[model samples]
Target: MCGLDHHDDSLLEAMLENNLLFDSGVDGLYGRSGIFEDVIERFELLVRRLGAPDKATRIHFPPGMGRKTLEKSGYLKSFPHLAGGVHSFEGSDRDHAKLLGMLEAGEDWSDLQTPTDVFLTPAACYPLYPTVAQQGAVPDDGRLFELSSYCFRHEPSKDPARMQMFRMREFVRIGTPEQVCDFRESWLERGKTMIEGLGLPCHLDLASDPFFGRGGKMMAISQREQALKFELLIPVNSEETPTACLSFNYHQDHFGQTWGLQFEDGRTCHSACIGFGLERVALALFRHHGPDVEKWPAATRKLLWED
Candidate 1:
């Protein structure tokens, strides 16, 4: 299914068989088992330890965010195909009755729900911009935040690395261009080190977002040309092509301009973020260390679970 070959299909089946993952009958939506979730939590703790010195402000957001904030983020302009809006039944009892009738008749009823004022968050850092903007100008030392959220994208695939709804852990920096660029550069190496410490081989490469449509092609090209994005790749599903488990992005004045974020000097701030794909990283660990946590390397287990 979904153009998956024998090898890929087998790998997916193995995960299912081991009880690390549960198939939800949807390609990109699956339930994580207890062991799988434990791995993710341990990984997050490791990340916190690695980043403790930064003293970044920590924030957690839910799966959905204000649609107005999303509009200001320009997500629709870049990746409309991957965006998801939340809808609910905001109709009268008559409409509800009709919807129930349709459901009983085995017909469409989802249309009865009107679009809500919120949308599923596309990234962990999308809401930060507007929040910071509301707080006023940035300090001279700049702002750094540790943020995590359940991000949603509409791209369904057999490749387990590309989940439609997944958790993203991000370290966002907002400051002058020099400060933000430095943060992104430093995280490139930090990301590699973090993944390698988990017993997974990883490499950093220049990358771009999967922007949508013809115009998006140009945006991707420009992003690559400007060296605005980088990803830490690992062999989760395939050793040859690899998958991106972490990303470092430098949004030079993009979010600042969008949200009217500024520095004390009255110049727009620059922004950068380091994102970790929590599920993908956990999967990579499982792929390398096997499904049984007891079978994993002692050092790796200690690093993740003990100290």
Candidate 2:
């Protein structure tokens, strides 16, 4: 209800009443209803089936990652505002007493908590870089990983498509420039086809991340100019401006140089990743097909529920 316009409020009510989502009474943080979880599971299975021939290495990471890796990933430089650091109480009994008093009095008690070694992961691919770098060099054909994680961002909005915490399923490829670039390009089309198969109207478009400040603005422009990022957008909340349900990115030696990732040939490995926003995609399906899962199109139900 916080700053949500009439349209968003109505949509939120519908979703809540349908039991597709459970609001935490906080913007951007909501619990998934049973149907939501079921849909996500089916979607992930569908994604895995689509990529089965690729034989990508599957890896699932926890919601948080080491702060050091986040630093090394250069996330702070670009998305400092969106990054979330985990913190916990690390004080003595006296501090605990004070914290309790403050909490009881409805005063600020967060100061007692200190930052931990881990930070909430910002992307599905962030932790993969350091782990891959530890392996020394990539193989001749390079490495491909299927990664998924719950990513956290600080941005909160009335638009349900934009959530502070959401799951991202990504396929990461590392190899020569051509190899990585080709991987990204292939997924660009593949993503479109998969979404279309679900009967969702979508389009791939040139896009860039929302960078932080003045310097970030320049970085965003440079990224777009280099054609490094693209997103598959679908109309979720509005038709005029669509939400990005999937994204493809090419990091030309940026991560390689940062994490010492290299090819067997003594050259830095270029990397590309295709990420699917699981929640957004499910939400898109719900918006398009209406709330009742049993009433959805026969083809859609068969595709999701049947083999």
Candidate 3:
């Protein structure tokens, strides 16, 4: 296999065997089938309909974000290992000749690549903070935004649920601590209900972002202690290690401070966001309801297919 040795990746094997996922000859990367895409689209539409009453401002972001924004966000300090930086070949004619020679020789020609202004976005909400800050301050009542993007993480795994590139559909709230907290709390229940309605077995649990390094251990502990994060878990790959298909988070002034986001009253705004891992959710559906949509429970199909 492409850069991967023999491993008992049961879910991945099943997906490949049944033609639900087309192999890219690489681990953690595959061509999603049309059936998979349909599920994701229907799920997202259902989410939008359910969230309509919230009147969140819809904002779509590309898969890449500014390198400066990523730097200022301190992502490198916390999760540098997961960040994907873009590099480009910015060279002259002579350099091009050398690069061609290296390619022919099968040498590592990527060292000549220069860092580009863009980096693959780590989360759907990462770009929203800076965008809001640029607009000056949040309103007294607070602000809410709906965002979606293809996020990139460096970790490659044998589990089909863990893809390096995936879609994250998020709803973000910015305001005082109370406002943000309320949003996360509501979403925790809402997310669970949505998943349960689809007939999948799931539960909500306290969770933390996978922070990095020695200091990150402390951060992770603090986050859990404060209950800053919660995840809607479902058994996609295995029951022992349930996949976090949905997450509700409270970012108590971290993004506010980094992006200089402020409220109309001048105090820094607190923020929270709920992220739906679209691909993971789809995979979970496939796992629980069978790869063929026609064979799924009627209620489940109606929930996804009906207007």
TM-score per prediction, in order, is 0.96, 0.96, 0.96
| TM-score computed on alpha carbons, candidate 3 | 0.96
* lDDT for each residue of candidate 1 in 65-104, tens digit (9 for 90 to 100): 9998898789999988999999999888899899989999
Scored against the true structure, residue 265 in model 2 reaches a CA lDDT of: 77
Q: Looking at model 1, which ten-residue stretch has the lowest summed lDDT?
A: 1-10
| Collision count for each candidate, in order | 0, 0, 0
Clashing pairs in 2: none
Cα-based RMSD of the predictions, in order?
Answer: 2.9, 3.0, 3.7
Please give, for residues 175-219, the per-residue lDDT of candidate 2 as tens digits: 989989988988888889989888788999999999999999899
Q: lDDT score, residue 37, model 1? A: 95
Model 1 root mean square deviation, Cα atoms: 2.9
